[model samples]
Target chain A: MAADNDTISGYTAAFEGFEASLNGGARSPLHARRREAIAHLQEHGLPTARFEAWRHTNPAPLANGCFPPVVTAGKLSAEAIQPFVVSGIDGPLLVFADGQFVPGLSRVGDLPDGVQVHSLSAADSETAAIITANLAALALGAEHGFAALNTAFVRDGAVVTIHAGCTMDVPVQILHVSTGQAGLTTPRTLVVAAAGSRASVVETFASTTAGAGVLTSSVAEIVVGAGAVVEHARIHLHGADSLHAGTMHVTEEQDARFTAHTFCLAGRILREDVHTVLRGEHIESTLNGLSLPLGDDHVDNYTTIEHVAPDCSSHELYKGVVGGRAHNVFRGKIHVHQAAQRTDAYQSNQNLLMSDDAEINSKPQLEIYADDVKCSHGSTTGQLDPDALFYLQARGVGLQQARGVLTRAFAGELVDRLQHEGLRTHVERLVSARLDAVLADQGGAR
Target chain B: MLKITNLHATVDGTEILKGINLEVAPGEIHAIMGPNGSGKSTLAQVLAGHDAFTVTEGSVRYENEDLLDMAPEDRARKGVFLAFQYPVEIPGVNSAYFLRTGLNEVRKARGEEEIDAYDFLALIREKMALVEMDESFLKRSVNEGFSGGEKKRHEVLQMAVLEPRLAILDETDSGLDIDALRVVAHGVNQLHTPQNSAIVVTHYQRLLEYIVPDFVHVLMDGRIVRSGGKELALQLEDKGYDWIREETAAAAAATQPAGA
Candidate 1:
């Protein structure tokens, strides 16, 4: 037992050391926050399987390892970032490689009046003040250890603020590319759409190689002020051997509208936790997610929508497909506070298991304290219907092609929900490639 | 083109098809008429290689090939089509895409080059006209939310497109109205060639009148007890299956002594 205790303490100390190296001697108020966060994490320590959010998704792989902090050696070229740009959106671009900001690869053209796009490290005094005021306001008491660790190691993340009543014509794209020598990388982001302001933002995380054993911990904070409409999308396309842990914290004020789409593909083990708080009345939030995990990959999505005020509405839908020995977990909770009368909340999670050995765990929960609220939650997990398969086969389609048709249909439902045509099509192509890989493996097995 | 001898099948330990025999030749349309639970649908499913039915005894031959030994898809590739009584709804697969996949797969299995998209579109358009199906049917998901008539028409469209050597219409006219039945039968008739054949499995003779079968077989207790030239279907329609059941029992008693 003493040996076990010493090994655990040693791992925690190594994690602390890793957090300190992310600062890299950078001097700023954000760095001060990082110092405070590290101390806080040290006191609380990493969460274990006892935590409800971390129960089904074990973090032992992350907690027990030693990883070096990644730093930007140089700016990634434009050509390297062009393929990731969301089509049909012309706005300022910010690029990050290996968790560090690269200004040379970014484009900050003439922006609309009262709109600012700058990194936390390069922000002026007033801008920094604005960021400091709301940087980690919504990330309080993050029970999940990875979120707390990301908060503590916050180095260079985007800080966008749109002034009241300002409307940006184009969305801002923040592309984070991980190019490292097989190790862990933690990326952080903070976005704010002020009162009565409207904007769209797209965040993308991708890897350059098939480096195994890589880890990426990301945190995105979104603040939708009163009467504001903000659309945010996050895409995760890491290497097959990479582990991803991401948290999205959203706070919606009165009469605010917030919409988010999360796409997770090609990760070894991924756990995404999304928490949205309706702070004021008449606020609306929509959350949509799609994930595909193949081979020995494991993907978990945990989301919580809290209704703290009266007359708020929220809708959530998440779908997943798992093949091979892959395992997927979906846990969604919608909580309605006593003061939140007339709250309307809905959530659903659907999963398809392609192989007998593949597994999926889904739990949709609703806790309501208000009497006048409407809330509903549903979840389903099942294998392909043999009758449906035979029906397609009788039409002359081979067994493999029939399976592909059904699997694509399962993915097409979520793809149709994407608002952007180009992104939808692009994601569909990725889904196709993933299915092709599954079929190829099946062929190899035979 | 098709032959079944002493066909015996079971489901869930219960025998459904027992010692059934039938034969179909090229350019001929045969109707198997029977009451509910008379194994009408079982014969179609067994011939199409449905996994639910276990062929405990006997054999099925299509074009002199051992049909029972082939996979369901292989049977389809060998030009055997089963128009489902209850068409399965594939929610995400478009009708056009599903048909094209089926067509190309069959062509490839036959050592033929796959048809290009343009040629496929043209072929589908021509078949869709035979059923009077709307152009939007091609874009909609397969059989999902389709009306009874539309699903039947879609089935006929598949038959016309595949041009199978032997097609089995399994209660294809169950839910269709008069006009839809005419369209379905017209599509089947137009696809009939000297080298192709059909087996219409139906409960009523109304569909047989439209499709015009050359022969009729009365199936009861999983065997063909009576065979005639189209008049058997009309007799079963007019006098009902009770008369045939009585005659079958009497004939069996006469052939096999009670104490043997």
Candidate 2:
């Protein structure tokens, strides 16, 4: 126990060093905010195993060894990262390589009046002031050490603002790519849609390194103004040896609507935290996610939706399939405040374990303080039925193919939630590729 | 050709098939009729190598090979097929893909090259016609949401494609209607050949009218108590099973006097 305490103290000291390095830079409003966040993290230190949220996800990986901090001095070429772009979205594109803005790779066409799409460092005075007012306002706090650390070293991310009553037909794509081995990078994004504005954004993270230890900590803050509509999708397909931690914070104004989808497929250890706050009446929010992990990979998704106003609605569904020795954890919580009467919230998490050695831990919780709220939560975990397997075998299908078919069907339910045809096809291909790899590995082992 | 000699099987510590003996030669169709719990289905399951049934004492020889020693899948690879009474519903696995995989697996096990996608599609189109099944059925999940008659027809389609050396229809006609029974029987009859055999397990003789078995056997208490030609099925169907039960009891008593 004494040794454990010393190890934790060492990690805190290293984080203090990281904070000092960031504050030593020039002073801008963004820089000032980063300095303040580092000071806050220094006072709080890293979370321990005793923390309920960090119980299943141990932070020893981050604290085990030294990882050199990476910074990008100039923009990356668009031709070098063209293959990583998602096709068919016409809106302005923001590209980031190694957690720094890559202006050369971006293609921003003519935008509507009062619509701004720029890097955090390149933002003008007015835009920077708006960002300062809301940056890191919804950080996960000391309970989540990665979120705090991300805030401490946060350099350049994307910031978009749509003025009142403006509607954009195109979707803004934020592409974040990481290169090299054992490099740690944090990409931060802040989105604000003014009253009666509407927009859609797609955020994708990919790794160019084959077998590198890349740790990416990302945070995206969304504010939907009154009567505004926002649809956001976040996709994570990092390298198998990478560590990914992401948090999404959404705030809804009166009569505003927000929908977010998080898809996780490839990564070594991934922890996703989604927190949504309904601050106005008649607001709507939807949170959906699908995760497929194979071999010894592990994924954990924690989502919370808070209803702080009356007549608000929120729905969340997360599904996962685990094979080989993989493990998955899903924790979803729906909270209704004391005065949040007439709040309707539904939360569910389901998992399918393909192998006996695989494990899935799911906990769906509802904490309601209002008497008139309707909130419910449920979770289930199971494997393919033997009877179904035999039925397929008797039909002449080999055992392995039969199992793959069933597992795909189990995860297909979540893929069907994607309304966009192209996105759905892309996600389906990713899920199928993951399944094929799992099958190939098992075949090799046998 | 298939032969079963003194086959005794147990399920869950209780004996279900005690000293059962029968023989089915190629080009012949045999119908096994019995009352409920008479072990007719057990024989089909045993031949298919279902793991739940323990063959405590028996020998199942298929084409001179020891069938009892093979795995269920191995039995399939060796040309033995069982049409389940309750076909399992496997969602997410398309019917066409399932059949193609099964066909290619058996082909590969026999040291033959696999069929390409174009050839597979052609083969499936030819086989689907035997049961009057639509091409659209190939896109749906295997047996998922399929009606009882459709599932039975699907089974026949599989049997038609695999062309097993010995096929066991385990109460395949139980839930099917008259028309479905005729279609299923027609599909089975079309596959009959001097190199192939079939065993039809049914509780009613109605299915026999279409299949027209070469030999009919009555199974009771886990053993065959009577054997005759196709006419016996009609007799049993008209008179019911009570008379056969009484005759079997009297015959047993006569064979061993009062004190033996």
Interface DockQ per candidate: 0.73, 0.40
Model 1 chain B lowest lDDT segment of ten: B229-238
Provide the TM-score for each candidate, comma-separated: 0.91, 0.83
Q: Write candidate 1's Cα lDDT for A1-446 as tens digits.
A: 34324434554565567556655653555666666665655565555666787778777776654455554443466776676777666688888887778888887799999898987778878778888787767545637566766766555778788999998757788887877455556677777888999988888888776647677888898989999999888887887888788888998999999988888777888888999999999999999988877788788888999999999999999988777777889888999999999999989898877767677888888899999999988888886778999998897877887888888898788778766666677667866887777544321131
Q: Which residue pairs does candidate 2 place in steric collision? A: A396-B102
Best by lDDT: 1
Q: Which candidate is the best by TM-score?
A: 1
Worst 10 residues of 1 chain A by lDDT: A437-446
> Which lDDT tens digits does candidate 2 get at residues A1-446?
45445644554565557556665454566666666665665566555566798778776665444345575433456665665566665678998888888777787899988788889878988888889888887645667666766776777899999989997656788988887446568888889999999888878887776436677888899999999999888888788888887878888999998988888887888889888899999998999888877777789898889999999999888988777777788989898999899999988898877667777888887899999988888888887777777666665556787777777877776777766666667668877888776554431132
Worst 10 residues of 2 chain A by lDDT: A437-446
